[model samples]
Target: MKRALTDLAVFGGPAAFLRPLLVGMPTVGDRARFLARLEWALDNEWLTNGGPLATELEGRIADITGVRYCVATCNATAALQLVLRASGVTGQVIMPSLTFAATPHSASWIGLEPVFCDVDPVTGCLDPARVAELITPATGAIVGVHLWGRAAPVTELEKLAAEHGVKLFFDAAHAFGCTSGDRPIGGFGNAEVFSFHATKTVMSFEGGAVTTDDGELAEQLVALRSFGIDRNKSVTAVGMNAKMSECSAAMGLTSLDAFGETRERNRENHALYRSELSGVPGIEVLPFDESERNNHQYVILLTDHAVTGLHRDRLQTLLQAEKVFPQLYFSPPCHLMPAYRTDPPLRLEHTERLSERVLALPTGPSVSFEDIRRVSSIIRLAAERGEQIDAMWAGAVPA
Candidate 1:
């Protein structure tokens, strides 16, 4: 490999194009709106949760996601907590094992056990069948995350929830614009929450929201997010300040207007990656999110080590040398985290395998097709050179 023309902290190198993680990041116009809102707050005496800025952002998000009601929280984590608390959840909440750590943490926060279910290798969403099999006397709700950009199998899960008389919730953090059949994602479950962290698709710079068509449940969440203050002037229980600040909402309003362009650019970039990587020798790249790239986040399924002829860590390092930085999407499945140390993750065969092999590339609106091709070329090169790529990294100097 040639010398890195630019460090990842800057423009990145050929490796930059190859890697999933990058140092410098693209900007969000919505952020400017957030700054302006911050100015408005400063100009006035309002800050935190009381300003009009926060209200506007929530109202606008409710409009965009097509939900009848929306409530903004400090972050998606808080939003999930609010929902679970408001719903009065008790006992275990079923969810996929192959997701980010924060996902399962919510379960622990509310004193609910997180029952890890398996995933479908193709899409990486929770497997409803496995979820059904895991249902027990203590199970109260099912928390399904929209892994990658695709929506989880809502219809099946809903059926299972109904049969078992349990609630079903969807953690839609990765599904900013996700759809299921004819409707949007938030509409599918008993309740759904979205994340707007900077790295997410429709980031608020930092925020999360809960959307539901159920007017009663939506009202319950309202009280829970605002220190359990019943906005309706009736106190049902104790709640804390889980509200999104006015500034964050301002930024989100701006991103909402231009989110379409971002998703479109990413879709185009992904197509190029697919074209270049067809039929590679190591393993078949994942096709789940690929099918839904027209809408949500982008992700790749690495072929298992046995067939790919390469381990996930080795491929990651090889791509990093090319300046491409991919992440082991869920290096440690949530149930495996220290929070649940003794409560081991359930044996969802596919979810376990997926956590060990999936690697999501950078395909946000900012990434160009040129970037995609650059990354793909290095992968092809690795397949050609095989284990020889390891030699290149084994000899690198410590930085």
Candidate 2:
């Protein structure tokens, strides 16, 4: 066993082996396509602020997401802020702390108190029951995050919001190609924000959009994204410059052309991970059964320290030494961040536990099935010989 372990440490030359993916890379031919579209933009001389390409991208997104209205923005964070501001969300907004900091920051940007709520242990999305408990007289809305392309309880959350006369919104940064049953993710709640950041399932380099069925809300969002200018050039509302540029729109359209292929790759990668990692002791592969469509992000939960004899961080360190890089998405929840810390803090039990245990393994179209098998083997062997792996990692480091 010791001899076999040593072989893994030196099996492949560090520089020669393909480095594990830490971010999403644009699909091949995206550059040429983007450049081709840019040529048209240069010919037309419409650079930004609702140019033709941007308008076309907006329409395409609306059509794809099955929503009546879609407004492109500079980024997901800005898209979120625009939705909240345009919806007249004031006072307190109940949201999950188990998300990117931008979720809470968007609320703060609109001068709303982000009351942190707990999430479901299995799904890592805002627990609808916990959200109900957190809502109060001051609560103006609920911001549920579709964490890791998993659908939150959209129907239940919408019902709750409707019953309470509060709006329901989603920070659907991970849900571009995801769906709830047959209905797509963006066609839910008051408005759902989809991120096109480079790391997401589909990307426009750096862009986002808000999907809604309400025409009035959509109009307000369009105005808010620009400097409050309507079609009549009337400065009717307070706004900012959050328009998606012609270049970004061009990239988005190009990326959209390849999303069908990307979605299939994501599904294949997820299946590979589950097939390889399932039945490994102490490792819990969260149920991927809820969503009919998933933009795969490989999140493995190290749920049992006693069974595995190693915590999540220790396993991460060992994997790093093995040239397998896994990320702790939302390691420190929003409430724990320096900017959002409060007096005595909020008790988010699930958020803290999930943050510590969750490890987002390298995934996406670029990652291979062999890569999944390798990562799984590392975890399986580490669980079998925890102390030995730790010793090996320690010895490899220069004193």
Candidate 3:
């Protein structure tokens, strides 16, 4: 493996020598609980289509999110699609370019033009000012994302949406357990959709849900999820089969049961990163507000490559060489995707810059304190080399 990596390095884009650490992993407790739930399911013989487990998961998730109603779906993308359809939104929906492609794809799939807007570089969320500037008579809604579990400026964006009389949708895929003061993420906006993908802090193996305070919309969502079927078992609306299966619901139930432990572990990892990476030159570890009760993702921004001889991509390669593989959350940003590109194209300077430098380190329940120390040391060494190179270049430049 070492020889292969060395040879690859010689030719550029080396073969990875060590077993790559993944960003998300299910714990042993998670496995045991999941098996127990499956056993219960096997005994009951209820498999899918809003079964008892699915209903319980919806209720528990609703309670956890502090929302009046929650409707679970097959995945967050389906949840987003359901929300956009139920809201009766049309024309254009303004959304941040610095997000997963699903955000824009949902809007476009619903026949609404997705107008990509820039985000605040620091938060990687919709900038209220930029959103306001982009609002037009044709604009019917605004979809704001809480990137990396970091809360977007919801209050400001809500105010802006209200003033314009446009519907506000929040893509809270990364913010399942996130809270804003006393209110959780799902309690905000016209509706907030969450992801329970295997990678999230909470996993359903694969599932999602949409939360809303409106009773009518909640009913519509429930119907929408199950092929628009009403209590009479008649198709009421044009809906598809996006309902969360019993197995996924079982997984979600256990995940919620185990959420506290997972969240705390992730938070501890965040603290370790802070302690190790703080004041490290050429690398900027994003700040987390302890007051906000966050499950932090280890996202570092390579702000000045000149100072850190290794840029984000190069640093990722070096980390892989050490068997520490990090993931890039949203590399090209939504606007840069070939399907979503516009005529002149949206020149989102901040989004472009962030896509170039943002890197997500190995995180979640599986990362250990020792692993954090090793990753931090490698980053520090890379930054030191970067600083030296910067100084050398400064000296070499002619007056």
Candidate 4:
């Protein structure tokens, strides 16, 4: 533990950790099983194009998500694009600005304008009231993001979409294996997309899937993921190459097999963080719902600079100096990015405020309980001496 500001690595003292603790370290499970599946794929010489392994993965995901059809893709962005294309929605899509850039990118890439909306201050998900306000005759769809494994306002978004005669879908990238009430996340909206990227709780060695109950839409998606070729070997529609390989599917299967254990470890880590940072003033470890099934993928913290006397960025720098690398997720948010920036400048009060305060700490299978404790100790110490640290930081900065 750091005794004084000078004892910190930033002050030329030894780092608390020799190696950097990272957020979103890949969770590799049962290596032997993954290898065996990989070997099978090799022996069969079936690498891609909806091979048997990919088919099995789709089935398993469908079963888990409680959706009728699961169309696996090369990545989540492609899955989103495919779903948007298949839905035939046009003009503009309303989405929270507090999401990964891919959410807006997917829509914009397919010729639809992405209108940024503010999120709910508490949940950090798309505000249904804001969505209602954004609806217009040209509003093609409403895309809700399940931020940090928490479900979006699904019921309300659904109602709004239905009332407005617009389509609805979710970017369930952070919400794989999560639930809202008893229903799984992937089963919500017209269709939902799950990201199995290396950073996610469940991974397919870089893959994603779109889950939906609409048979015709599913059929269209299946064809679209390929070269728009149908079962009859006829070109049905314009499409892109977005099929998940057998190797990725094998990894996906292994990830699913270990999901239970991973979820448990993540849950334990979250609990430990909450306990370790319990009474730290102006420091809040975001809470997950106990009633709903959650992947517990993120260990997020919200810092109140006024109360803590240290800004979130300064706290982040202090932690990083100790070799703990937390992420400022969705900072500069999608709306603020150069590609999406409006001429007049868009102001999303909630998103802007939350983006400055939110920080994602290290968790997942890679992080241990002891690591959480140490990280929390650094935070507690910093908060305890926040003013001093702030003064030190300010002095260190070159005028």
Candidate 5:
């Protein structure tokens, strides 16, 4: 009988393999739970917008997010578009260049010019003070990205937006379960859009939502998602078929119940990685406050610049060879993407550098603390060996 060489594979005795494609927690609901809701939808035959599960899910989400109203949509991008349109954003909208392109793309899709702004290197969030500097007479609104499940300083941005007399819309795709002070990450501004993509803290299989307190805007969003239906099919304004189907909503209903435990697991795994990877040479592991962050993705900054004879991309390849696949979540800053190529409002040096260095380990629900430990150890080993970890771009794919 042949003996196995190593205890790294999931089937090979180790609980974690080198590059286990974790079942990401950003899940909406369990199979049986969501399937049960699906059965409900099937029973009622209310299979479209405002169905039982959809309404129920939206209510639960609003309760979770501390918002007065929630509008579930086909996807996060549509939620963003609806909010931007409903808010009357025209001309320029200020946004961070370090985030996913969804923020700016939603603006552009709705005919608003996205004026790129800078981010805070420490927090990887749009700096409110820089937001002030980026505002112009043409600037219509501020789109704040709560990227990587870390809540931005929304309070500061709120003050800045009010002072500038512009609206603040949060692209809160990564902000499920994230909170600030007494409120969760919704309804703090004119609107905040959430993504229930399979990769988010919460998932509805594939859906998104807009949370707001304004009834008029909420009304508009409802009308807007259903092809702008007015009395007798008289279209009031431009809208799209951005409705979340019953299947998605049913899944969401199930997701809400079990998501708390998944969230707890994520936090726990993150703490382990944070403790294990700290002070490691040539790498910068995170140290975010648990009270504030949702710890959606356990990321590190590869100080590949500090490591001689090594680049970022080669490290990824080597990790892949070892079956330990860590993600370079944002390999090229959003501004560097082909669709957004233009003269910048300012250079995004820090943003670009971060894109080259940031590495996201397996922090999903399927990934155990043991998984993080192994991944962290491999990263440290790679850094010690000075393997070239080259940079790679994840282009234009919206978060």
Candidate 6:
């Protein structure tokens, strides 16, 4: 609908929509069911410290993920930290820089040094070849992240980890209800951590879980989450208070009940985006494997400045002015963040390049089909008029 520069909201014209279309909006399940569960938790008066609801949630997660054991935590960070510690790994941990800061932060917080690795440019997941190149006697473990709800190079990473004799795990924050081949994500490696944060498709308001088939490791995690107190109620090992509350578990159950419906909606939105953006120069919608089960929670885009004549940041700004807000998921990647920056500075070519180009558009239950159409139209308009917009930006002074 926007015909020219003068018609764009960024150029002093009216916005395309009355309200902002935002990315990562929380998906609310059946309101009545959620309220009933909340009321039950309150009536029971068991809020935290491994209550009935928390225990039930853990069992459900284990069942859903096809893992023998599941330990729910206050958040994914805590789950990661606990899993890394309980896996009995020491020294350096290798992980991709193209991820949320929490991935490395968890390792670093537990006194392990995080070694940054580059990712596969197309998949946006850890490159096993890079991991092989980085492995040393000092490397304690290898962590792979499932980006955009797509499975990481699980088979290859498993092979590398086995050959090197190091522990392997996954940061499956974006991969709940997703699959790696015939298997579920949580069953991979020594363990996998999933986030149930509100933003996730299957949310618990604010919670996370660690899944594993290792009984001993599961016991250790159980003890670790509750300050290392064993059945006899005596301190055994150094631990942190990272238990999920009953309220969060109740919400989690409700969310799980609505998973199928939410996933369908997400799938529809993703399909609409792909169809609408097809053949639009310089804009690519990331694809998920059709054969495997996926949550389809994120609608990712890769902007090619060379073709579009506008970089990803400028395109994002243009969209935002029209009251459509997309997200730069991991622009300043983990290795580039202040807390995790390397001494001599690391140069991960693929990681750096992908970080700059990747953008997450609005999707999920909150976004309607019409919303996707409007957002897609805005992108198409920007791409079509990229040269003129680039020139206008070049001539304009910095604000």
Best by TM-score: 4
Which clashing pairs does model 6 show? none
lDDT of 5 by residue, 106-209 (tens): 88987888887778877788888888888889989998888677788899999999998999989888788788776788877899999888776677889999
For all candidates in order, the CA lDDT equals: 0.73, 0.82, 0.82, 0.91, 0.75, 0.91
Model 1 residue 271 CA deviation in Å: 1.0
Which tens-of-lDDT digit does each residue in 1-399 have in candidate 1? 433212222113343223355522443765566577678777876777646877777777777668898888879998888888888889999888788777878878878888777788777788777887889989989999887767889899999999999988999887867777767777777889898887776767788999888899988787877777776676668887888876677677777767788777666766677778888876555554334433435647475566555677777776666657787888777656666545443455676777787777767766777777777876776666555444444543223
10 residues in a row with least lDDT, candidate 1: 4-13
Write model 3 residue lDDT over 67-174, tens digit each, in one string: 899999999999999999988999999999888888888888879999988889778888999998999999999999998888899999899999999999899998
Where does candidate 5 have its weakest 10-residue lDDT segment? 390-399
Which residue pairs collide in model 3, if any? 309-386
Q: Work out how many backbone clashes candidate 6 has.
A: 0
Whole-model lDDT for model 3 versus the true structure? 0.82
lDDT of 4 at 58: 97
In model 3, the worst 10-residue window by lDDT is 1-10
lDDT of 2: 0.82
Residues 97-208 of candidate 4: C-alpha lDDT, one tens digit per residue? 9999999999999999999999999999999988889899999999999999999999999999889899999999999999999998899989999999998888998999
Off by over 4 Å in 1: 1-27, 30-34, 232-236, 288-296, 341-346, 390-399
Best-first order by TM-score: 4, 6, 2, 3, 5, 1
lDDT of 5: 0.75
Q: Candidate 4, which segments miss by more than 4 Å at Cα? A: 1-12, 396-399
Positional deviation of residue 200's Cα in model 3 after best superposition, in angstroms: 0.3
Off by over 4 Å in 6: 1-12, 396-399
Superior candidate under TM-score, 1 versus 3: 3
- The clash count of every prediction, one per candidate, is 14, 0, 1, 0, 18, 0
